[model samples]
Target: MTAAEAAADLAGGIIRPLFRSGLLVEAKGDASPVTEADRAAERALRAFLTERFPTHGIMGEEYGTERGDAEYLWVLDPIDGTRAFLTGRPLFGTLIGLLHKGQPVLGLIDQPVTRERWIGVAGQPTRFTSPMGGTAACRPCASLATAELSCTSPDIFDAAGTARFDRVRQAARRVTWGGDCYAYGLIALGLVDAVVEGTLKPWDWAALVPVIEGAGGRMTDWQGQALTLHSKGEVIAVGDAALLPEIVSLLS
Candidate 1:
């Protein structure tokens, strides 16, 4: 099976169960929520990669880094949006991305409760599948003027952030709240125009880069910098390239 397919299956099989089981959840030092499901999901993904793609390295959120020197690496966030998961919200998801020489080639975001899978590969079209087994070809909506905007949290922005966010909000036709990792998935599906967030880790944003860019959107830091694995979390993804300058201006 392809890497995208393998990731979907593994995430659904191993990670989804934990969401359903009501596993114990705890807080990390940063106050982010984590659960047994997160650990188990990463373990399952790591084991699968080891056996299937033995030479590939692995990096995950729950578990520390391993085999970092390999030519290819799989970055896993077994559960993104653990806070939503812990609160019984279905906005969380399992994220998997494959990087070749520090560049992402494939990405998969799976929402177990919703059964929504968004997948993308470099140089290919992004696609989304729903729980009822319907599939659709993804495309970024035409322009930002007609676009809808969204973010993980309004509080992500302080007074400065709030001002910047308001600028983008005013420019858009509509703005929706919540969806954490799921927001990026929506951007890939052409359902949302942009998603911005702050205070992110590598795992939080890594898997999302390819998915958004592959879907014919632009993914970058607020200042228009290329997002790297070592990037400090502030991100702005937009379907409309022309709108980016305006959005960036607000952040500036």
Candidate 2:
């Protein structure tokens, strides 16, 4: 199987079981909640990657980092929203991305509870598959004039995030709250027009980038900067090209 396919299968196999069994949850040093499920999921994914692509490097949230100078690296976020997952919300997901020469080339966000998977490659069309065997071709929103906007938390920005949030809210025709990584997944699915967030970690934003761009959306730092693995954690994603300039200008 291709790397992307293997990653997706690994994610599914890991998350599906914990989500079904209702595992116990706990917290990490950052105060972010974690569960046995989260660790198990990451371990499974790491083991799969190590065995299948032994030459590749790996970075994961729970286990810290492992290095391999090979041309390819795998980045994993076993459970993107442990807070939501612990609460039994279906918004949580498994995020996996492949970095080729330091640039993400493929990404997968699998919502095991929802049985929804959003998969894409850097230059490919984003595709969505549901548990019912239904599939859809996705693209970024085509119209800025009547676009919808979303974000993870209204509080990510502090004063700056609030200001940027206000600008986006004022510019968009509508705004919906409450979706973490799931918001970006919606953007990839062409269901949401844009998403703005702040104070994210690499694992938080890396996987979403390829999926969003592959779906024909634009993702950048708040200042309209290119998103790198070392970005400042602020992010803006838009489906409409025209809307981005306006959003950026207003945030500035």
Q: Identify the candidate with maximal lDDT.
A: 1
Evaluated against the true structure, the overall lDDT of model 1 is 0.78
Which 10 residues in a row give candidate 2 its minimum summed lDDT? 134-143
User: Which regions of candidate 1 deviate over 4 angstroms?
Assistant: 133-145, 158-160
**What lDDT would each prediction earn against the true structure?**
0.78, 0.78
Write candidate 1's Cα lDDT for 61-117 as tens digits.
988778887888888898888888877789988888888888878888888788887
What candidate 2 gets wrong by more than 4 Å, as runs, is 20-22, 68-70, 132-145
Tell how far residue 62 is off in model 1, in angstroms. 0.6
- The residue pairs found clashing in candidate 1 are none
- Cα lDDT for residue 147, model 1? 80
